[model samples]
Target: MLFYLTTLNLARFLKEDPPFIGEDEIDVQTQQAIDAWKHAEFLCRNYLLNGLSDTLYGVYSVKKTAKELWNSLDHKYKAEDAGAKKFLVGQFLNFKMVDSKNVISQVQELQLIIHGIHAEGMVLSESFQVGAIIEKLPPAWKDFKNYLKHKRKEMSVEDLILRLRVEEDNQGNEKRTLNPNAAKANLMEHDRGSKGKNPKHKQGPKLGPKGGIAKKPKFQGKCFNCGKMGHKSSE
Candidate 1:
């Protein structure tokens, strides 16, 4: 708002007193100057009031001069903005990334805190924001953090976020690849345990080496009825 006023050349009315006309002795140029000053003052004051909310408009509309309204607003909101700035700074300093949460989501949260700080009139460089994000990464990302820190090229916040997203995706793919192998190993171990716990039942009669049932040997000696060397009477 102040910047806009400065651009319009009306900001002087906020700092300068209104022009005075002497009784019965004013030059045409002096009268013109006074009239111009009054017009500018009116514009400046109306602009300020129009920018306010309905509640604030009603509250501050009683101020007759642009300078008074400007000072009152500055006095009120400046202190509030200062307190908000400190809170935002604290939030930024205390932000930490955790392994259980998505890194991109956490980065976004940090970005919001940065935005709040900027809105409160505190400016942070892109490189500083990038460094802060790296420092706040979870313990699992220590090696990656070191790698980023050792790089010679400086990165903007956007570039840093892109790099982090790629790294996170790679890590996710690796974990996905390892999970199936771990599950397979666990399944095999479980199967072996089940087999050990319940041994197989005893098998049926043994078969011949060729996997066929063996026939009984013929009677070599004479049978009781025939008494012959190799024949039985019944046969």
Candidate 2:
């Protein structure tokens, strides 16, 4: 809006009031200057009014001069913008990352909150923003967050985001690699448990030629020295 007003050289009209000269004392030169100023003021006022939304236009259109309209708008929006800045600050401070959501997506949300702060004319340094993001990482990322905090080199927001993406991808790959091994272990444990609980799956002795269970043979030779029958000498 300031640039638009500056382009037309009518920005001064917002700060300066229209020239006042007595009708009885006005000369041709003074009259001409007054008319020119009036025209410029009119253009300035119209520009300001046209820039407003329908709601504000109705409320401020009755302002007679550019200075009046500009002052009124400044008074109204200044407080509103201050309140908006406070709300954005609160959001930034309260934001937290959770394990269930994507880390980069949550970082983007934090970036947007920072953007809103900038739009409100508040400046947040890039290093500060990077630190804030690290501080807000999920509990699952505590080790990585500590590593980031301990780095001696300064990091820009872009660099921080890149590092975060790499870390997130690595973590995801590690989980993918471990999942199959974990499943295999669980399956092995379940098989062992089932075998222990049910004894019907155990194998019995082999069958003989006639399909009867095999048995040990009894001794039939007599012991010569002892003159005993149905018993072996070695027994």
Candidate 3:
């Protein structure tokens, strides 16, 4: 809404205007005054309809003139706007990475929020932003945080963010190098666990060398079946 007004050079009309008196009641007014008033009315009606809520539309709908609606909204909402800016400042101050996001991502998010804080009227210096971001680093990042703090030169917000990205990447490579064996062990353990529930199958009885029963030995001149000495007996 502000941008719209700014582009058209009509922002000042909303913030400042001669005490609006009825056209008929005014003793003397210039042609410029009349034109400004007409444009403000036309733009304000459109702004309220398109930009604001139906509730606000209803609130301003009853006003007989656009100037009255503009003034009324400014008086009522501008005072309430203070709380929103305060909340933004609080968020900027209490920003913490926790463990939910990567270090570089958290820092980038913090940069966006800091920019928003500046837009909301709390301008912070580049050095201050850089220092605040370092301070808010999670406990696991103590070494990097201290390294950033102990730097002799003041750094811009972008510089600090770039350095943080490089540091995070270096740390990731180091972890991969030192723990490759541990990672392999974990994969092996998981594979073993996947088959842990089933029992092993037992082997069946061994097969003979030929696909037939073994031949029995016979005694000299003795019946093999009867085991008696003499002629072989037929059964």
Residues 2-110, candidate 3: write the lDDT tens digits.
6886787666656554455665775545656666677776776566556778777776777655456678878787777787788778888788888557988888788
* Clashes by residue pair, model 1: none
Worst 10 residues of 2 by lDDT: 195-204
Best model per TM-score: 2
Q: Give TM per candidate.
A: 0.59, 0.69, 0.63
Best candidate (score: lDDT): 2
What is the per-residue lDDT of model 1 for residues 1-235, given as tens digits with 9 covering 90 to 100? 8899999998888887777668687889888888888899999999999999999999999999999999999999989888888888889888888999999999999999999888877899988888899999999999999999999898999999999999999999999887878878899889989888545668668798799887766777877885777664475
Cand. 2 Cα-lDDT: 0.91
lDDT of each: 0.89, 0.91, 0.76
After best superposition, candidate 2 residue 137: deviation in angstroms? 0.6
Worst 10 residues of 3 by lDDT: 211-220
Clash number for each model: 0, 0, 0
Q: Model 2 TM-score?
A: 0.69
Ranking by TM-score: 2, 3, 1
